[model samples]
Target: MKKAISLLGWIGVIFTIIALVLTLLTTYHFTYVKYFNDYYTLQWSIFGTMMIWAANMMVFRTNFKNIVYPITCVIIACATMFFMYMKVY
Candidate 1:
């Protein structure tokens, strides 16, 4: 059971990393007029949030020592939210 949980935690971490990368890339290149018509950026942002949340939960349950993962996620989420707010207003 512990091994399975550990595997799941690692999987979560991987997903979170991917999501973060995607978020960064999208944020850097996103254009509201050209590629934001279908709400793709919104979808990606939502997915990234879910991935980060899952990763934090898994890591917390698995007793991971590094607090960096969750901290980074929080920072990323805040930054993303701030940018999203700017875009909306």
Candidate 2:
């Protein structure tokens, strides 16, 4: 069960990276500017979720201090989402 959880966590990280790259590509392409709002929201959510999973992995491994990074990421993500929401709509 632990191995499975770790594997799933890694998969989530990969997906998050892919989503981030896609988000950057979309930003540069600019063809989908109209959909930027949706894309950004999805990207941030994926990233935030990935961070939480990573923090969980640290907890599982007993690396308690390492959890701070993910927690910070989550906070940043929340702030980003709030700013985006205010700016876009």
Q: What is the C-alpha lDDT of each candidate?
A: 0.57, 0.63
User: What C-alpha lDDT does candidate 1 achieve relative to the native structure?
Assistant: 0.57
What's the lDDT for candidate 2? 0.63
Q: Write the per-residue lDDT of candidate 2 for residues 1-89, one digit (tens) a residue.
A: 66776677777777677666656667778545444434665556565665656556565755667767666767766766776677642
**Candidate number with greatest TM-score:** 2
Across 1-89, the per-residue lDDT of candidate 1 in tens digits comes to: 55665575566657556555655555667533444454346545554664556465555554556666666666776666666666641
- Which clashing pairs does model 2 show? none
Compare the candidates by lDDT and give the number of the best one: 2
